[model samples]
Target: MTRYKIGVVGCGFFGSSLARELAAHPRFELAMLCDRDFERAKDVAAEFSATPTDDHDAVAADPELALVVVATPNHAHAEPAIAALEHGKAVFVEKPLAVELVDAQNMIASADASGSPLMVGHIMRMMPGVRRLADLLASGELGEVAAIETSRSRWIDTDGADPQWWKLDKSRTGGELTHEIHELDLMCWLGGEVTAVSSIATADDGFRNTVVSFAGGAIGRHTISTRSHTSSWELTVDAAEGSVHADFHTGRVSRLRGGRVEESWPIFDVDAENQSLIDSASRTQKYNSGNGGSSLWMQAAIRHEIDEMAAVLDGKADSGSPLTYARERALVVAEQVRLGGGEPAALSGSAK
Candidate 1:
């Protein structure tokens, strides 16, 4: 098997985690780590046995780097991704694709022209529960999903903090576009393309909450804030036969049918024999399985995506097309923010 050299741009939590994981994967070598903060990038690079640099162009220019992961702040996603693709590297980008639709379209076009695969880290779509739900929906077990509701909220201590942060800025992080777009993507993936959306948003103390309606008559409500103490997400789908609820935070699933209810505990031991369609269709690849304390759910999703990308690279699998759909869903969320009538704020501070 050919080992791929991977470069990571951004030394934040997500980027650092991915770097460490890639370093451990036997199929990938962490070739470089980049960050605006030289010290932070150097620290992460040291941990992964990779060179640390403040210059993204150096990483993109590296002949050994076959893949690049852009984990930078929301506003910083486009340039590095485009640069890496232009330099002939496959790319994995954290969500929202880009802050603006135009940037997102450009990124997509670059990947198309470069003939290099581009994947968006809408990680929730890789979740076991989500995959199971998709399977159920496809099998018609739910019998026509009538409506879907999802919420993601977390409170971060930002007292006396800068109010013009990327996460709060409508122009950069795009508020819900960074955080809750996963839910939007999941809703659309399980439901259908959202033809239209109407939303209401509130911005105060650097937080926003919005509710939206999708095309297939499915409604979605979202709350994203840096002011909550706990991170919680739940998705409920109402169907003709009954309803299914999944507490994404806990990885628990509940079902109601004919007034009888049952709850399923987390399936920690993924059934090795029963491979999902996504799994079976994915390319085979070995990943550095790191320190092993990371969340199993997260590991599974990352592995699935890595495998899918490997397949695409190997010409044994189709390019992961869901990213385009995820992008469309993000557009709807962006429109929701636009129609919601929130106060305009300049982009400042890091998106993290």
Candidate 2:
């Protein structure tokens, strides 16, 4: 068995976590850690026994590295990812792809030009529970998807985040909608391509509600908030045959007809999932600060995506293309940011 050599740019919370996972996996060798902050890179590199550097260009130019994981701040994603892609290195960028439309387009274009695989990290879609729901919809077990909705809301513990925290900068994070794009991307993936969307958002854009029209004639409602006292992450789908719901808060997905559940599946392992939630609540009832200590369920999702990336490298599975699902999600977010407080707007491209 040959291990693909990989390196991670941006040695922050998510990037370091990814490095740790890749190091532990047998199919990949974590070779380098890069960050603008040398100390951050050094610390993470020490843990993983990988070289540490502050130069992304060096990482991109290294011939030995087959993959470059871009876990930089949302606004900074394009530069490193585009560099790696242009160098013919497989690149995996964390979600939201990019905060702006132009940057996203540039990243996609570079990937196409270089013929290197580019994958965005949308871990929600990789979860076993979400996969089960997607399978049901694809098989028409729930009939045609008439409507799909997702709600993700939780309070942050800060009035305003630390000045150094990029998430507090709307220009960088694209507010809550783009920052919490997992649900937005999930709706499009599980439902279908969006034709148009109408949204309402708060002044600060910390809360947003959007209605999406799908090319398949299905509709979707997405609601996200960062100001809720109670925290929940759930999705519900309505179809001609019946309805289904998934509650990540409780790690359960159920199929229903006539208001009764016909089948139920654990989102992950039931005991571990429940324990993770308990531990999470005991630590902080508020939203995760991305300072580490993510739930076991989330860790599992990351591992699953890592496996997918490896499979793509081994030619066993197709790369998770940014041109399709990721672009679709980014388009919806762009429209949400544009027409968020105005009249309904059609998606920029032709309907699916």
Candidate 3:
């Protein structure tokens, strides 16, 4: 039984969570933890008896590390990822792939030339309910998708450390449109290729609405904002057969027929503890167990991806997430260039 040595770069919020997940992974062990913040890196590294280093080059340069998870901030994704791929290590990059078009393409090219597997972490694709929704869409139970729409809105106090400020610069996070590229990838998977998209963004607030045209003639409309007082995440897909609406937080699903709600899936009841996949079709969800109250649902999605990556390494399966996630990132960058002249929300009382 051979185990893959996994190194995690950038042990911040998501990075630390991924470190914990990788440490517990059966086939992969957390070999190293890296962060410019030395103390934080040491804290997470202790969990798995992994060594901690501040040197990004050391993590990439290690041939013993079979996989490196690039959980760095958005702007930081490209370098460590490309370096690891170049060193012949498989790479797992946290979502929004990269903040810039050229960086995204270069990451993909580096992986291609190195023959190391590249996977983008789109947490939504890991959700049980979302995967079920995708299943129904592809099952033809929904017939041809006529339209697909989604909304993601959240409000932060912005008074404390103000992490939103990390994302305030489009260079660091890629404005709201680019930030929602995961949803866009889901849109492409559920419907088809998005042949064209026209979007309008509000002032510096990060509110955006985009009208999407699909190659299959199906349409998509998206409204995404990080400025709202009320938080939400909902998605609905309409098709010739029926429609399915999902509440991302609860994993509640609803079936619609004749433009009226036919039934609401008791996903919460089925997954009483708010765990497990309500729909049985989810092979990914069915096998994975709990994380001991660490984080539910979305965290489960991350573990699912980790396991899939292990399978890819074992030659039991092909790559996990599609390369199109990388391509769509390029497309988002192009669209943002056309729709731009917008700036990220300014950090309060900071130097202008």
| Model 2, residue pairs in steric clash | none
Local accuracy of candidate 1 as per-residue lDDT tens digits, 57-127: 99889998898999887778999999999998888888767767667777877887898877788877766
- By lDDT, the best candidate is 2
Tell me the whole-model lDDT of each prediction, alpha carbons only: 0.66, 0.77, 0.69
Ranking by TM-score: 2, 3, 1
The predicted structure with the larger lDDT, 1 or 3, is: 3
The superposed Cα distance between candidate 3 and the true structure at residue 16, in angstroms, equals 0.6
Model 2 agreement with the true structure over 1-352: per-residue lDDT tens digits: 7799998999888898788888989899999999999998999999988999999999999999999999999999999999999899988888878887667778877878887777888887777777777878878767788888898887766644476677767788877778778887888777655667778778876677888787789988888877777776889999999988988766688999989999998776557864674455334343326576556766777788888888777766643332234454545555455754332234332121
Query: Candidate 3 — which pairs collide?
Result: none
Whose TM-score is greatest here?
A: 2
Residue 149 of model 1 has an lDDT of 74
Q: Runs in model 3 with CA error above 4 Å? A: 162-165, 180-182, 260-294, 319-334, 337-352
What tens-digit string does per-residue lDDT give for candidate 3 at 1-352?
A: 6799989999877888888777888888888999988998899888889999998889999979998998887889999999999999888888877777667777878877898777778766766566666767768977888998877766533344344556546667775566556666566456655456667777775677767776688987777775766656678898998999987555588889987888776433336434443322122221122123434544576777787677767766543244223334334423544555232222111110
